[model samples]
Target chain A: MTGDAQTPALPLHLRAAILLRLLAIQGVWNYETMLGNGIAFAMEPALRRLPGGRQGEAYRTAMARHSGYFNAHPYLAAVAVGALIRAELDGVPAAQIDRFRTAAPGPLGSVGDRLIWAGWLPLCSSLALLAYGLGAGPLAVVLLFLLTYNFVHLGLRIWGLHAGWTQGLRVAQALANPLLRQGPAHVARATALVAGVALPVAAHALIGPGRVLLGSVLAAVAAGATLVTLLHGRFEGWRLATLALATFVLYTMVR
Target chain B: MGGDILFYVPLAVLGAVLGLDVVSFPQAMISRPIVASTLAGGLIGQPVRGLTMGVLLEFFALESLPFGASRYPEWGSAAVVGGSLFAAIPDGSAGAMSVAAFAALVTASIGSSSMVFLRRWNAIWARGQQRRIARGSGSAVVALQLAGLSADLIRGGVLTLVALVVFSPLNRAIVGTFSMSPVISRAVVVAVASAVGLAAIWKVVRTTAGARWWLAAGVGAGFIIAGTL
Candidate 1:
């Protein structure tokens, strides 16, 4: 609190470089380690204040936490890092980052946990499978997948970092602020939107043209109808089950 | 074992890369399932299958955001396993894809737990080397980083190899049993696909009520597009 306000902050390029390197401390090569590393990074400052006062304790803590976080939520960890780096650069105070580290975990974790684990992963992978079933090359599939995922991920990173540095946590707080009032629905919706776009793109690319298209169309209709019915409270587990059975039967007969 | 080695080597490499990326490198592009799995699938000469696996894996991976030392699954390795396994199977074998997906799912579950152990190990390693590291020696840093990456590589490689070895024969047996009945085979595929869908829906349903619609939209759109094609 006593430090000069005008103390030469880390240069933008240097900050970015440091951020990038810090991010690489564990690397995003895998989810488990990534979470551990991310958590470690997020908690680096706090770890520095711990009893040992070791020289590289912060980095080690960051690395460990990175693995921890990655294990729990790989995709969301990418976004959280985006937000964390932003908060750091903005000089919103290390305490704020700590608060976010504490507050954001459970809620965001819940939203992220459910969306990725239960919803998007299965859906997108299934579509990719459907495409493979149609015979697309591996390069094309990989390329497309990379393009779509990075589009969102890199975009979030850049956006989060920029906002955190320029607007500070005030901006991030504002963006995430609604969560406090609106609950987890907002995150769920955001996740759905992103996953929604991703799923069809992969499916369309994979399925190509043929009866596969027909089957997909029928499936879409049923899913849409089921969603609407559920929204209206008219959808029961039995009804949904029946719809699934019928869809399978129709697909079988037609194919 | 020949194909198994080929399959697992890439997965191990991917695990190493992703494990590094999680905290070591901020490349911010490769670790994603879409990219990782597709690459794996391509390496195996089945990009489409890899991509499909990536998409599904992406959903499951959506929640991963490393805020603190909390354990999460390594989708990068998991995707490689899922994609390669699915791609290895003959095209149009939905049943095979399902089994592969299940295999990957199980691997990821176990991987999540192993990550926790690695974290504690890393902490201990760091604490042990504190004095040397503080004195400007880079050995501790290098050792810690290497330890994480090496462990990940071993984990991914071993998991992929074992899962493929175990599941491939099981899949063959299952398919062989149902070979005569296209209905059963196709049914199995649909059932697996639905399970995947249900998993996704369950995630959406648990959080925001609104996500159910989005989930439906994605599924519906996918279904339509696939149908039209």
Candidate 2:
């Protein structure tokens, strides 16, 4: 045990500095991926076209630089930075940090990107929209969006960097799996519930008394019927459209 | 006009918070269009308009997720700018909101480039600190952290200032080009807003039937709420 080398701990300031550097890196990377010609998009296609030989290996190595796994999530990169800085400050060798940087980005970026962008973001934003439609104030809507989005983003980044790839992958997988499978279904159910509630609520909130409440009650009943019709598979796109049109006409005539 | 500075402070703060959300700070909810634009709108005195702007921005922002070193537009900042402008202007003109939204979109594009520059700057700073950091110097560590914060603050503040000044006058000019028609203006707003909602739903629909329900509910709810308000 005495003969084994000890790992170095990074100082607090160093960790902060490195985290900032990582943020810069993630931000620039994200911008480039979006505005540039998207080398990552082309990599898979180009890889399939390559003949098997030394040329393929060389192509593979070059492709590694633009690899989807490495370039994907920007948020998780912060965790890697934190980990590296911590390692360095604690007397862990610079080489170890370098190795971790090289290895961590690919896996974490791949998983984190898919989880945050493809899964959580869409889900949360959809919910926020639902709330907004229900007459939630702009402040409430925005605050909820920020609260949900940042918690996931920053939490993952910090955890990934500190706990390393394994923990990050586990966390991402837990959340993302549910999203990929049932997120859409849940969104739909929630949306219907909100719609049913909102029509009446909005009428009450915006329009005062009498006819407004009557109109809202009628609309709510109609919405409930539509949901049931939809669930029963009796309502196709055209039918739903017709129903909406009829509702609009009825609402107009009544008002 | 001196009172205008108060308006600008919140706008600047919004920019800073959103910019931080993009990379430096907690990645939580700040980037969402609903959150960012509404906050901007509230700061400017029109919450409903802000919410509307936020929804449109959110739709357009569907494609943006910070992955790696890619050059993506900063949607959070862009939405704030767009939302604030739209909310501030009266409801009778399409051109004002259109110009402001377009300006914000363009500003986001430029912001992507600025992010790239900042990255390179960070890399240079890191390289310079390699030896000192390797030697475990505490002073070098503090300097680097301070540098990053200062850079971010300046980046956000400057971007917001430039966008507000340039787009405000541009919005007025654009609005002046045509007689303001309330019906036509509202029509334009509704069209843009609907398109955004539709686009977002389209993406969600590809995943599950639930998205369709959500979409229908969202649209119906929005209309009802807007009508009531």
Best by TM-score: 2
Measured as a fraction from 0 to 1, the native contacts recovered by model 2 come to: 0.14
Tens-digit lDDT string for candidate 1 (B1-229): 1444564665566665654444345545466676777777777777766776666555445434343455556656667777777777776653554455555666666666666666566666656655654443334445555665566556555655566666567656554443323334333333333333344444445556667687668656654554454
**Local accuracy of candidate 2 as per-residue lDDT tens digits, B95-158:** 5445555666666777777777776675566456546534433344446545755676578767
* Full-model lDDT, candidate 1: 0.50
- Model 1 chain A poorest 10 in a row by lDDT: A1-10
Assess the local accuracy of residue B31 in candidate 2 as a C-alpha lDDT between 0 and 100: 55
lDDT tens readout by residue for model 2, A1-255: 111233334345544544444444433222223211122222223222334422454334333333222343556554443343233223344454345545654555566655666557765676666566566777777677767766766666556555432232222343345543454365445534443333334323322223334444444444543453444333222223224423432343344
- My TM-score estimates for the predictions, one after another, are 0.59, 0.60
Task: Tell me chain A's TM-score in each of the predictions.
Answer: 0.43, 0.44
User: What TM-score results for chain B in every one of the models?
Assistant: 0.71, 0.78
- The number of the candidate with the highest DockQ is 1
Candidate 1 regions off by >4 Å?
Answer: A1-9, A25-141, A155-187, A190-255, B1-11, B18-34, B52-73, B92-95, B130-146, B162-183, B205-227
